[model samples]
Target: MSEARAARPWLALLAGAGYGLFYLYAIGDVTLYGPPHWGAYLTEVSLERIFTARSTLMFEAIAVIELGWVVWLFSPLNLFLALILAGLLAANMHGVLYIRAHPKQCQVGGNKAFIGALPALFAGGACCAPSLILLLGIPGLGAFGALFGWLLPISIVVLGINRIWQHGHGAPSMLEYARQRFGLNNPSTA
Candidate 1:
């Protein structure tokens, strides 16, 4: 592969990492305290709590790392979940980038990749819903708790299904399907 082609995968990986970090921050696993102070670091790990679940799929943080002004509550299970979601997102992003680079050849619009991205974004929201629901004073606490707990898992399943579906359909097939669904006039068929 050429230099540009080689860089695309790396770029996608970076995007995934950025999103994973954002998810961690949103869920209160990672936090910022103040300006960075070089050479300041402290960490604590509780092996006993490594596999504990705080709520539904949410796991307890078995480790804590304090680096200068940043604090991270590390949970292996949660990190694994984040990585899975991020990897799917990165794969979709790579598809989007590839489509953008060779639009004429791909034929399919980049919107499908954008649609694939929605699940991960929505999954991130699931992480923050609990705090938001409490602050908003929602009356149906129990029902909301049950619903919110499953949102992340549901999003993961959706993303997995989308990945399989996208892989099974080639660009031309997807393009034709999009045209049919949206009533776009395909030159060949016209």
Candidate 2:
């Protein structure tokens, strides 16, 4: 496999861990905070509106999805699946990074796999933070949300970009290097 392809599993694991940590931190922050001061910000918006049963359900869904993602990413039996997941994640990372670097690239599916995963990422964040903030009346949940929701995604995207840069900067190309070193084919093409 190409070097990039060979490294897919590790990359996937790293990406999964990154996202997992982000979620964990966000969840922890909300659980600790209590609830958001929406009333302080808006006269019309009540805590009940923010923390509806539907919102709680949404949070549960996010928790399930994130937990599933973490399990799949770390499961040894799911290496191939992890690789596939990594590819999608890499695409999303690329998309986020691209959008950051070039604001004009935010169109849906503009980055294909990357953009495809945006909804999941956003949903994950929303489910984790907004729901908690609504229900608990937390103080820093918004800040936490902004940090993980925005910075973490951007960081992951930058990580992917850096990997691409490092892989492409040398002579033989990452694929050739991986093929020679690990007998791995270029799965990116596959």
Candidate 3:
């Protein structure tokens, strides 16, 4: 296998983790505060609060965890949602890497994988902040504000569909690609 193919899983995992951190940061669950060397431990640990939202709004944080340089408001629902988004993003990125590594084996374009990631990036900032809707200052937009809550879900659906579409189109195993590239034709077929 090519080095890139061998490292595909690791690359996707790294990408997913990075995206998750960004997602948390965007949603205000995680924040950068204090000196770099500072750190703290988890606080307000409660099982009852796990399922309960502090407010009536969706995606409310349940617990506060402080690691001095970074503070995280732990919310299971939001974390799960972030994981789903991150997984989908990782899958799409994996596809892009595969396409780049094995161009001849794929019928679909590589850019679709990248295009599929756009929705998640766009929606990440709006997860907990509906400031965009308020900034519009348009009358009768109160109802529209609810859409911001669905941004992550909508992104999930889009990425899911894009993944299905891409996979349904064409993908070849790395072993097969390597065999073809190296002209290691099967003797049985020959």
Best by TM-score: 1
Which of candidates 1 and 2 is the stronger one according to lDDT?
A: 1
User: What does candidate 1's lDDT look like per residue over 1-190, in tens digits?
Assistant: 5524622666877887887787677677888988764343334456657767887787888657777888788889889988977776566555555555554555655665566556655664566687677778888875767677788777677656655555544422334434644689989868
Output the worst ten-in-a-row residue range by lDDT, candidate 3: 169-178
Estimate TM-scores for all models. Answer: 0.68, 0.29, 0.67
Candidate 3 per-residue lDDT, tens place, 1-190, comes to: 6745632756876887888887778667888887644434554557665666632334566667777688888888778877877877677666567765555566545565456546654554455455444566667777766566667667677767665665665543334434654678867887
Off by over 4 Å in 3: 1-7, 35-48, 54-58, 111-144, 172-190
Q: How are the candidates ranked when ordered by lDDT, highest leading? A: 1, 3, 2
Q: After superposition, how far is residue 146 of candidate 3 from its true place, in Å?
A: 2.6
In angstroms, the error of model 2 at 143 is 19
Off by over 4 Å in 2: 1-9, 29-110, 131-190
List candidate 1 stretches off by more than 4 Å. 1-7, 35-48, 123-125, 131-143, 169-190
Q: Clash totals for all models, in order? A: 0, 12, 3
- In candidate 3 the C-alpha lDDT for residue 139 amounts to 70
